[model samples]
Target: MKLLSEVEPEVKVSVKRIDGGLEVKGNLEELGISEGTELTVVATEPVHVHAGPISLRVAGKETVVARGWADKVYVERGGATVPLLRLEAGEKGTVGTIEGGKVFEDFFALLGIEKGKEIEFLRHLPDDTLVLKIDDHEISMGEGQASKLMAEHGGKNIQVNYLGENEKAKISKIIGGTSLKEKFEQMGVVEGKEITLVRKETPAPSPKRGTYVLAKLGEQLVTIGRGLAEKVWVE
Candidate 1:
């Protein structure tokens, strides 16, 4: 009976008990970690990613956003479409594509990062996050949530959470079948959102260990703080 976070790497442990509420239990269960679930711990290292500020000029408007906001914002550079993140300062391109699916499209659409829009990587601003490790199967919200989150991957309908670690899926539909939709919506877990299973933990650590994420929507900028950022995925 020990906290997964406190466990040393390479030690095999079974989940004896999970300390928390239903939300915690549910999140752990989704990752296939529960009582009696035996798993080998791997070297856990904290990985941090910082998003720099990306200045953009959109339709005569000037705005600043976290570098993450421009990740999916594609631009035409040298007749080749590339991520907006690759553009250097003073580089300009046409909005050739808005990837990451409908939810992202709607987000970028509101920011005017759509087709035919002239975009410029005005400049980059600086800014300054964690991930637990397992058998390379980072825990992703699984089981029930995965069951409810029916996603269309490779033309097949599947639960988003049930996906293996590092497995990515696009949420095609959310069938809460009751109040789950509202619950999922509260978390912004909606269709058109792409979800990825990162890592899993035993004894079910906190649903959120406070991972920092910077999400952006083209020229429309907003800063998302921690806590809430871990639970919400941009795509």
Candidate 2:
């Protein structure tokens, strides 16, 4: 057995146990790293692990780990594991699980990705980017963002940004803290709500200025800041 952080790149391993108290265990579990889970070491410097249906950054030289925390995560070499982000174009796999908090889960779920669903991996574009075919739609994502998904190839599961001007789409997900979620929800930006991008106005000539987005949410017209609008995922 060995600590996950100590595993070599491309090595496969099965989690034997996670040694930590409730808080520690809970945090790791949220990232999909737990006992009985199988994964592979994608990298070591930042400690990337393809845990189940998600890829995770476990530990690193700059990351502080509690005493005995990493050691508690013991693993046996050689297990089945694959990360969705690592898949090449033309490959396909089933959605296994997602690693992250409730907000992250909700975000992906709203985008039509969830456990047990089938997805086809498209080609990787420039700037560490890639595209995925989910159902009848194609969603593009960045590599860093895509690494959080886990899947099995021969048997795997695994696992968004921006909208365009003058485009109409249904609300797929929102990415932000509680306050942001509530703020948008209150503005009728909840998932499944159809919205249209009316216009993007330039920032006013003032020190406290910012760009604004005008849109139609249902029967009402709404305006949102560009920063916040970027967090709103549309399909």
Candidate 3:
């Protein structure tokens, strides 16, 4: 009788019921989580969960994808290149190339990944955490705050979560509306402020489930959210 988000780490729990919309349940099912399914809470401090599905046919390695990161993944099908989100359930394509520079090519290289990034893309973690450095302090934003944040970068307005990795850019503009704007103001994130990417991760494995897309690409298990899974195309 506990919400998945409230469960503690290392405690074994069965999914008695999942309360979400059809798309939420569908995404969970695609990721191999459903009712009557048993899951172990791996780490709750970071809000991370690892459910090793013994029955799942998770072909290869597991690498979590992030949102905003998917826009760069291009799949080759019928001699044409398309984004991963464009494919149907049964359709398949080979991940031919990746754009953005060279920040996240390591994961894609294993699955015939071409090459690629300079930020404007977050790690697209499983839960809804988006971390960034404003000034000398690190800031973590929840899903709602993260999604609502729009910063002026590259001469246009973009999601703060979409800031490029290692790419230092001035906030220039912050469109975090209403309460969201107040949240940023409290944390000292404002227009004309320069933000830098905070990269110090050697992600091992995991995700309890949030807004990610579960993709199986060439023996590699990718759990991407924050709109990033679409960046890594697959066949």
Candidate 4:
């Protein structure tokens, strides 16, 4: 068993284990070594190995591993691996398990990272520049810095319920641009009308507080502040 970093480039080797570490033996381009990379052994007449989920074939006829190393190396496809925290634009790859011990796993978990989660690499590090959307609302995270915001999302359903009176009407004009509040008004929500909170469901730890009622009028739906809604004195 040899650590990928410890092994010399182009040395014949094989993988011996995958838990808590990766073992491989082969004539490899060490310069290409990266965390969470997948690999496979050659079988049948085609003497070669495949790497990554896409199974990019390596060590073809020209570069074959010694049979001794081939039998010892172990590899898995879509097995347990942690995705690395990517900080570049358009840079994408799956995660493999951490090379270190339990401490590494715990620390990564604190960063809201887990195996098998697909993350979009972002370019910046501050001011919500990294774009990630939950439930279709796009939010900006600090550029390349989104990886630090760690939390787990246990699947949960949050249902939004509508209440209060409602007035149905079509929109005739829009008062503003595409802001949520503006769109509501353009949908016939306006002052002096009543609407109910519609149903909404989402996972646990929902960022939204609760549902809202819209006042419908002309071609717009005017959104009233929660405080103002309480004072509406609905009849």
Candidate 5:
């Protein structure tokens, strides 16, 4: 066991309640963390564990958690932290607290994506479309149009490149006159929607033409041009 702030780098610690609050022992102090700081355990394998406020990443090197408030400590697995919705499956957790509620908790609610929500991943279709199953329903998006909606999950900085012929796309955009700040909401793009990327062409130089995303829009795959895709940011 280690103190609340003396844990070694990448050492995953189980959180437990003590004295009406929470406490973590063992090398916790090394990270400048205290008894009540919210920590997101970034990794829990091969002698690695860390807790922090922002996104945590585990790798061959020591695990690191972004420095910040402590509360509702999250547990991680593999190199990627488990989705906050799935953290209830772990043990040996280190307890902590957050001031404005749990970051992970709020993220799912805001996005309308939850752990129990079912999603399907599809690849390599005869029609060159990207298809997915959500809530037991089958949905398909043209490959050209898939990338735009998929970009919503690009927050981890993931990029996609692929295009198909005969696919028509529409630039996903928010109506300029509308007060809504999100294009996804304005365009009716949400979790469980089938989307795909049908093409990747470099239309610019130097910095390079950004990727274009196409998505299936209820029986029609609409191409989302580069400009609109860039404007529709996702976490």
Candidate 6:
């Protein structure tokens, strides 16, 4: 077995043993690193590893070991690991682990992304942006954020935005803040609720204007701005 810091880039490895005591082992475990776990070394300088479905890096460190803390992680090469951002269009993966702390985890959970969920890589846009199909939503994210996710590839899903007038769909997720979520929730826009597109008005001839969409939620008819409509994911 070799220390994780010594593993060459692109090598697939499995955790053999962690030589650290309770504190270190506990911390590593929180990041999804432990004996029998498989991962891949994605980078050497400022070491980064794809552990399970999460991508981790030694922040501010030139190597994987920080003050010898991570050196205790001994590994043997041979296992599968892939970062979500590396997946090509038409490919898919199941979320395994999330690399950050509670706050980051909670943030993503609110967005309907969590461990065991499957995501489909849609396509890449200009300027390091990419689209991912999560549930029935097409979410656009930056490359940096995508790099933090790791997954087991091979799944499929379709996501869309526009809907024909009078078309109905079931809400899957809402991407917005607490107030926005609360506002939508009060109008019966919560996940699993069916909504119907009543009417859509094209944007006015103004640089600072947006399209307007009328939707029916339960017994109520709500007028949603273009920006808010895009954040409401549905099937």
Highest TM-score: give the candidate number.
1
Which residue window of length 10 is worst by lDDT in model 4? 47-56
1-235 in candidate 4: lDDT tens per residue? 4432233322433433333222221112111222333332111111011111111112120111211211122222344322222113444434334433464445334333344434333332112223333333433422111222222222311111111112122222222224423434444443333223222222244243432222322222222222222222211
* Residue 74 lDDT, candidate 2, scale 0-100: 22
TM-scores for every candidate against the unseen true structure: 0.35, 0.31, 0.33, 0.20, 0.19, 0.26
> Taking the tens digit of each residue's C-alpha lDDT, what string does model 6 give over 1-235?
6666555555666767765465445445433555775666444331122111222222221111111111112212123345444444555566555544565456455434556666554443222333443345444533322232322222311111233444455555554346546644554446555544444333233343444333322322222234322332221
What CA root-mean-square deviation does each model show from the true structure? Answer: 17.3, 19.1, 14.4, 27.1, 19.4, 20.7
Which number leads on lDDT? 1
TM-score computed on alpha carbons, candidate 3: 0.33
| Residue-level lDDT tens digits of model 1 in 108-188 | 554455778888877654221112122333334423234445666767765443356667677787642345677766566
Each candidate: what lDDT?
Answer: 0.52, 0.39, 0.46, 0.27, 0.29, 0.39
Per-residue lDDT for 65-159 in model 3, tens only? Answer: 33233444666778886664444434546665665445445433432234331112112233444567887898875433444344567786555
* lDDT for model 5: 0.29
How many angstroms is residue 84 displaced in model 6 relative to the true structure, after the best TM-score fit?
0.9
lDDT (Cα, tens digit) per residue for candidate 5, span 25-133? 2122222333443333322122011121222222211111212211223323444433232332122222222223454445222323223332221111222334433
- In model 4, the Cα lDDT at residue 24 comes to 23
Clash count in backbone of candidate 6: 1
Those runs of model 5 whose alpha carbons end farther than 4 Å from true positions after fitting are 1-101, 104-182, 207-235
Ranking by TM-score: 1, 3, 2, 6, 4, 5
Window of ten residues with lowest summed lDDT in model 1: 126-135
Query: Could you arrange the candidates by lDDT from highest to lowest?
Result: 1, 3, 6, 2, 5, 4
Q: Judged by lDDT relative to the true structure, which candidate is superior, 3 or 6? A: 3
